[model samples]
Target: MIRAADPSDAVAIARIYNQAITDGSYATCDLKPVSAESRIDWLKQHQPPYPVFVWENQLGEVIGYSALSPFSIRPSYRSIAEVAIYVDQAQRRGIVGGRLLIHLMKTAKKLGFRALVALILEKNQSSFEAAIGLGFQRVAYLPEVAKMKQQWEGVIWVQKDLTASSQ
Candidate 1:
């Protein structure tokens, strides 16, 4: 099941996100593990059109999470949003991330977003393929834009035009 995230889900969200951060999975650029308290503050920033959603198991554990965040502060970019997803390492091979992302996409469209963008690491082919399978198109590539552990890496920018999809 997937639902809007609340303050209480911070801990589980942090755990799943930290897994990506620590495992060198190239899934995220965050270098440090986030605290649950800080995640609560992050959760507070996401409201209405831009909100965080968590995937919960039958036992009510948060196994994955996704969110639509403001793509930019400029008024001209208000119609676009950036999407992010993180799932527990144990659930990475499953459909958790895909489901969470699909949910986020539908919510973004219904909330008036014209496009949703995902910035994926160049080495994270699984995530790239998943995003493409969900209808996101690669729009740009930034080479050697990120330095992770003294090594340079690139980022792939993918976008989904919500207007082309059925409401």
Candidate 2:
């Protein structure tokens, strides 16, 4: 099931995120594991229009999660959001991540966001293709701007128009 996240979901969400951070890190630029306390604080930053959602099992365990965050510090960019998704390593082969992403897009639209963007690692082909298939198009690329595991890597920014009504 998918639902808006609350403070109690922090630990489970943190575990899923930390797995992605340590496993290969193609999923996120953040390298180290974050504490639930930190995630609680992070969760507070998201208000009405921008929110975080978690994919939970019948037992209420969070297996995956996604969110829309402020794209920039400037108010002019408030209409744009940076989207992210993460799935537990144990549950990866399923459609969990895609479902969470779709849910985020829907929520973003309902809240009147103008656009949703994803800054994806160039090497993460699955995420890139998935975002493209979901109607996001590449807008820009930062070449070798970050180094992971001693190797330089690039990132691509893809965005979807949220103004259009969904089919």
Candidate 3:
């Protein structure tokens, strides 16, 4: 099931996130995993309009999370949002990521967002394919945008319009 994330879900989310960082799929730093306290602080700071959603299993464990943050600081960009999704390694191919993404898209539209953008690492084929399957179009690609673990990585920018009301 997918639902709004609570402070209690922080540890699980942090664990999965840290695992992604370690696995090289996400290309993040090797810092210590974020604590629940920090997650609570983050949740408190974001306020109402912005939200974070999590995918949960039958055991109530958090398998993945997706969030929508402001796409740009300009006032004219207020209707756009940047989306991020991360899933537990074990749940990679189980559709958890897809469900979380779909939920984010629905929630973003309901919250009056006009568009949703995804910044994806080039090597992450699964994520790119998932976004394409969800109707997101690749609008740009930045070659050698980031250097991770001594290797250069590219980034793909994908977008989807959410202005059309859902039937």
The true-versus-predicted C-alpha distance at residue 71 of model 3, in Å, is 1.0
By TM-score, the candidates rank as: 1, 2, 3
Candidate 3 to truth, TM: 0.91
Candidate 3 Cα errors over 4 Å, as ranges? 27-33, 165-167
The models' CA-based lDDT, in order, is 0.93, 0.89, 0.83
Cα shift from native, residue 163, model 1 (Å)? 0.1
Superposed model 1: Cα runs more than 4 Å off: 165-167
- In candidate 2, clashing pairs total 0
Candidate 2 lDDT, 1-167, residue by residue in tens:
99999999889888888998889949888877899998899889878777999999898789999999999999999899999899999888689988998899888888888999999999888899989989999999999998888889999999999887572
> What value of lDDT does candidate 3 attain over all alpha carbons?
0.83
What is the Å distance of residue 85 in model 3 from its true position?
Answer: 1.1
Off by over 4 Å in 2: none
* Cα lDDT tens digits for candidate 3, 11-125: 8877877887778785243345676678777666556577988888999888898888888889999998988888989889878888888999888888988899988888888
Q: Using Cα atoms with residue i matched to residue i, what is each candidate's TM-score against the true structure?
A: 0.97, 0.95, 0.91
Better of 1 and 2 by TM-score: 1
Error in Å for residue 115 of model 1: 0.4
